[model samples]
Target chain A: MTTSTRVSARRLTKRFGDFTAVDGIDFEVRAGEVFGFLGPNGAGKSSTMRMVGATSDRSGGELSVLGLDPSHHGTQIRSRLGVVPQEDNLDLELSVSDNLYVYGRYFGLPRRQLRGRIAELLEFAQLSERAADKVDNLSGGMKRRLTIARGLINEPELVLLDEPTTGLDPQARHLLWDRLYSLKQDGVTLVLTTHYMDEAEQLCDRLVVMDKGRIIAAGSPRELVDRYVTKEVVELRFPAGQARRAAPRTDGLARRVEVIADRLLLYTDDGDATAEHVASSTLQPVSTLVRRASLEDVFLSLTGRQLDD
Target chain B: MLPTPFRPLSYFWVSFRRTWMSTLSASFFTPLLYLASLGVGLGSLVGHGQRLASLGGEDYLSFVAPALFAGTAMQVAIGQATYEVWGACNPWSGAYRSMQASPISTGQIMAGHMAWIAARALLACALYLAVSAAFGAVKSPEAVAGLAVGPLTGLAFAAPLAAYSVRARHDQPFSLVFRLLMLPLFLFSGTFFPVSQLPVGLRYLAYALPLWHAVELSRSLYAGTFEPLAGSGHVVYLAAVAGAGLLVARRSYEARLSR
Candidate 1:
């Protein structure tokens, strides 16, 4: 592995009895980069994340985190890495600050150093005012923030977040993204798993799109969008049961036409031209919207299914 | 810095601060009330009877106190291990999962869990012994050995029960364990009476349990009748049970947490 590589995996596989959760996949996470695994649920994203975190054993393959083998040096690798699981898993019985304090202790962090660190983390998570409140009493957003803060208590070089914003509202997700962005600014490598395409576009400096236990595509979000999809997309909503029948009429107007439930997506270089073609054509739509291509479209185009589906 | 194996204790210590009042009160009052109602109230009727001979020629109150001490340790340990261990693995309160994500290994987590149970057992048993002393149920200074015996017996149950709890997906199994295994062991393990009073089959079964060995050891020590070989045998037996349980718990924690 290179010096800049924080995590490296080669032909890593994880199997549960008869089921293969993570097929052989190779990826590298560099330092100070926000790397992401973007996939729908059960895409083996979590299994891959757990292996990198050194909490799950790989059935077969070579894996290294922080330049050490996880199979033999899990504790050592984990000591220098932070993990925020998909579920908050905050100790509901303890206060917000106590959660951070106790988690730091698990890393054998000195109590004296942890006190200052806890205060700083609580502030960083915007939970300084609620330090003494029970975790059960905190809102969903506050709990997510505290979970992230707890993950940072050990001052790890790399932090692994599994579906960090899976259940948060828009405002909460934005706040969390800002915190994560600031972590990146401080040069902390972040590896996260999210089914949210926008979240990947917003946070990931580089990412891999996974499906069925394999990394199907890996690149910068803009690269993936530019390589796999058009520059713009036109979304047309037709009358009930009309989207599929209307799909063929707009065939030549766009480079690609996809008929999804109740809507027809026209992928083209100019969404306005596609919309104009559709407006003058025999097909009549209830509504039409033109927008820039995004990771969502890239995922749809690659997998023939929505990212959140 | 604390050693790696004991790191997870900090979590229990922090959480204990919030519920220590109720926990300590229950620990203190449960034995006190049991001693008052059963030992004192019933001892008045049974103390002067020929049945005292079967109880080693001791007052009924003194006879039952040490057994209660050991029994209470088992109760407290199982009580702490069952729900907490289950909750630690459960989705809503994934405390063990949270710890597993850190540098701590599942082995360390298991060790820390048993250590916390031992600590709580020591505290609870100490209070029980003090109450026994106050009630004049403590017959000799050797009775202080109950402290060691208490936590040992507690661990014998806690470690294995924790292993079982780690695999339990729901709370229903816990209540079933309480109703079937724990309750039966608590009642028939010589806590309330001597194994000699039981039938031949039941008596041998009581002798096979960890709590009975603890009760017999505690009773002999409290009555100033401890035999070196017998006491050593009981100690070794309880330790073996606890050691085996810890082994199983470590494996279970590793298997479950690593997933």
Candidate 2:
């Protein structure tokens, strides 16, 4: 990924009358990088994506896409940007190939060129065999792939995906991740939002963690983990009734200790040392396991709440 | 360069190509059948005489052709204007939403939709005129002028409905348009019979509606009895309605989509 910026926003915000959806936030995305917005639902990730896509005007802020102001040059900016909204909006009246062909025409692409491109894209999406099939007949994963393929029809320079894999099975999510990896290898800038921590860790070169319309943290996923949490964590689960009472006994053994429902999480620099400390203590009577820190750990420490909750 | 607002017409044409068969059957054949059953089957009883004298002393079929032309245009235009616009805005297909992400702006999408509606009205009117001619409904060569009037009537309905449909979150209101608005216009406008036979109040009301003006304009053109000042009045009315519809629809589309 090049260091040159493709999208820049300063104090960008969006408000729906009485409610603020995207609070004032600042960030920049570089060309050819897999940038991500990591957030839970209602975190304003989709609202921000809409602004960068040039489909939704920013309520207040200075925002530039492809170096052009969205209010003045929205049409021009959108011409080169492909967007996959959180939901699949494929035309149900058209076939698989027609969906791509119809969307390509919106870019003012010539019919002759679109025919060839549709063929190539169908193959790229692994949907060549379903080109003539009606879009209604396609499975959920197939529809998602077609939506992504439709986004690529114009050969856009930057692609925005909002919650690209929200409701997909693990297998389908991985397949989409593979296609996205291939796109990144081709030097196309990628921006996406996801609630899945693993998706952010696996695909994002740089990302921002958003919560409640605000950017709580911004950095590479690894960097955020390193900054907000320790290197390792030990999971010590006790019987339900005894877990809350067992929390204070492991306090001085680690940098921090978190008591969730029935388990105590010990955060430290060394998992083996923490696990040993937990074993010798009278804190745990059920099970103990140690693992490396993750984005989930970082988020839990930052918000005092679980990522998926 | 083609105006930026009309650029989405290309997208409309591509999608229209796939559904032309069903679209043609609805917009063209349905009107053709109406002309046959109502104008011919019913007109046979009201054959050329004083019984038909109130119909401008012409055969029932010939007198009704222009009104049907206007009515058909309205039908075809409003058909695309409603559910199709709703479909584009709906989260399901989001055709307009998808286009909004491209180089096309909201005005362009509205222009393209209206253009497609006009295209359908053109085809439907031309085919209906031809069917009427086959049944000896054409009184003069000037009947072709109704081809132009067809889209104007269609736009008179389409432009307003298109604007309203963009803001519609559900389709229940669209069906109400047909039942409440369209049905009344078809029956009260000078489509089935001359407005001269109506009560004085309803006659003025008929004159106030756009379709009545369309029916009069198309009929005068087909009969070669064009009155310069009167004809200009009809033309001006339809144009004003269409122009106003375009202006309002443009603003509506711009406001709805930009958000």
Q: What's the i-RMS of each model?
A: 1.1, 2.3
Question: Lowest-lDDT window of 10 residues in candidate 2 chain A?
Answer: A276-285
DockQ values of all predictions: 0.81, 0.57
Position A263, candidate 1: lDDT: 97
Q: Can you list the residue pairs that collide in candidate 1? A: none
lDDT of 1 by residue, A113-221 (tens): 9999999998999999999898889999999999999898888999999999988999999999999999999999999999998999999999999999999999999
Docking verdict class for candidate 2: medium
Q: After superposition, how far is residue A296 of candidate 2 from its true place, in Å?
A: 1.7
lDDT per residue for candidate 2 within B1-259, as digits (tens), equals 3445666776677677887898777766776788888887888877632235678877787788778878888888888899988888886677887778788887778888888888888998888888777777778788887789888888888998888998888899999999998899988898887899899998999999888988888888777777889988988888888889899999999888887
True contacts kept of each: 0.86, 0.71
Model 1 chain B is weakest, by summed lDDT over 10 consecutive residues, at: B46-55
Candidate no. 1 TM-score: 0.98
Tell me the whole-model lDDT of each prediction, alpha carbons only.
0.90, 0.86
